[model samples]
Target: ATTSIAPTTAVATTSPVFVPVTEPPSATPPPTTDAAVAPAPATTIVAVDVPASTAPPIVVPASTAVPTTTLPPPPPAPVTQLGVVQDVAASGPLTVPVVDYGLPRVALGDSVMLGAAEELLARGFAVDAVKSRQMISFLPDMQIIRDGGSFGPVVVIHLGTNGPFSESTLNSMMALVVDVPIVVVLTGRGDREWIGRNNSKLRALPEFYPNVTVLDWEVVASQCPGRCFYEDGIHLTQSGQDFYASQISQLLGMG
Candidate 1:
């Protein structure tokens, strides 16, 4: 019985077997497995496009300019005839009559007398001239006019060149000729001593008589040109005759 039981046990009875199961070290499971993803990269935003605006241009007004003009000067005024006559009167009146008494051959008084005669004829007046050898020789003639009292307003006595006369004689003659203007023309051509003496006598006459007039021959000579006199330096030429006539006519206002 013992043998039979041992065989059966070896054959059918399995000994107590230990199965070893490895559970992957109790499933720690890769520490619950959360994946470590990289954090997302930061994003930057920028403005892409912008618009520009335009402005209008400014305008200015123009200025107005003015033009300048120039004017011409006026013409001079004309001289009147009355004014010319007044000027002539201011120098000496042309209304007075003239009587010339001078020697012709000795002192060229004939040429002067002829010129004066023509001038008086043009001025509507009668003229006469007497030529004496000397002024003293004409005393009788002057005395005749004085006695008759027919002499005019003016008597031109041109003398005292050939010879010298005393101041007393000249004064006496002047005194004898009364009631008229006596213009004593001093001698032009003569020595300086005679001229000085005649001038002295003339100056004395103004003190004695107011009616006595003294005309300067030197002044008349200054107005004469070279053609007015002859080459002899004493007498007047034809041109001188015409010039004297013109001067006398102008003084008388004949033209």
Candidate 2:
């Protein structure tokens, strides 16, 4: 009975509505196995210089970031000058003696003595020097010097210009003239190691013998340096001869 009163209302059809859905970026997958992989750091190369650098070598780790610039190597140390002033300091200041005007003296040595022979004679010293005779001929030369030592109050030994000497020979040489007043000049090294050794021996003489006086010729040569020596280094130049004579004369109070 109610359907007859209804005013012809149409029945609605049942249908599902379709809608588009967007989910955010799918969670990005967390990089999976790639995240577990370890990477090695990059490396760089550098040049090395020898003489300019005194510092120790630098060490670098592989994984560290490469430096933009390396530290520059330090400049090398200057070479020490030979025949410095300190070379003669051990011998102390030379005693200026009261000169007797023409005091008697004698000298014995090698080629160095040969250069000084003229100066020695000029200074009124009774000089007996043989060329190229080293300290090894100590016995023979000491006898010659000993004979003249009786006539002169002072004796100068210049033998080590040729080479090295033994301690025993040096002792034997010293024993021959202990009673005599002696002045032993230290030998010039001239870049030779043995000459330095011989000079060291001569420097030690005063400690053992009270009558012995050590003349630091090494010190004298250092005063004028290159000008004091000849081209041969050990031999005296004309100026060197004069200087040596003057130093000896002054030491003995002859000056």
Candidate 3:
């Protein structure tokens, strides 16, 4: 059989048949992704130092000042002058000139004078004292101190123990002894109120008459107590007599 198969072979013709094939590419589109965010850092604290020279100084307030004051004291009381001289013009100026000579002491009184009679005589005093006789006023005794009687350069009056007094009568008695230099008054005493008043009047005589001196027998009565007076509180006792004499002597510039 000489039948020859037509040789089947790839024909390379001018217009060749072609088959199409598809495969995924290796460059895929970038995968879709979100951006990453970072966290912030923490804050730190720091301390500072200060010097003493850089600091402010402190101040103090002062106290207020004050003033001081001083005062003086008062004057002392009178001694020989017993009290204030109120009635200085009770009488005129001293008329009788004071004679610096031997002045005799003459005393005029009632019973109290009698007690001191012997002592007065012994002390050179001419005493006109009455025994059991009453001189209740300055009237009856005016005659005794007048004329050339008990009136002398120096005299003692111890009346008014039994009665009241008159200022005129006392002034008159002083007038009767106007020529006399010194007159010592023996203050009277009794249970009567007038007695003290009488004594006060006598004490005030120093202002009116320069020669007037108060014996202050009241002082003697107070000092010597029971020994200076009798039971009646009016008459002078024996000790009183001695005391009276000594006082008169001192007044007469003898003791």
Give TM per candidate.
0.48, 0.57, 0.55
lDDT of 1: 0.50
The CA root-mean-square deviation of candidate 2, after full C-alpha superposition on the true structure, stands at 22.6
Local distance difference test, per candidate?
0.50, 0.64, 0.65
Model 2, 1-255: lDDT tens digits are 455565788776977688999878866686567556667877777876657767888987569776698778996542211121233333233332333432356676677777878887988787767777877775775775466434344666776777778999888887776655445454564777787888788777777776676666665676653476767677778888787776666655566
Residue 94 miss distance in model 1 (angstroms): 7.2
Question: What would the per-residue lDDT of candidate 1 be over residues 123-201, giving only the tens digit for each residue?
Answer: 4434445443355766776677557545555444555654567876787777764455433333444343575676567
- Residue 208 accuracy (lDDT) in model 3: 84
Q: Name the regions of candidate 3 deviating beyond 4 angstroms.
A: 1-103, 131-141
Full ranking by TM-score: 2, 3, 1
Top candidate by lDDT:
3
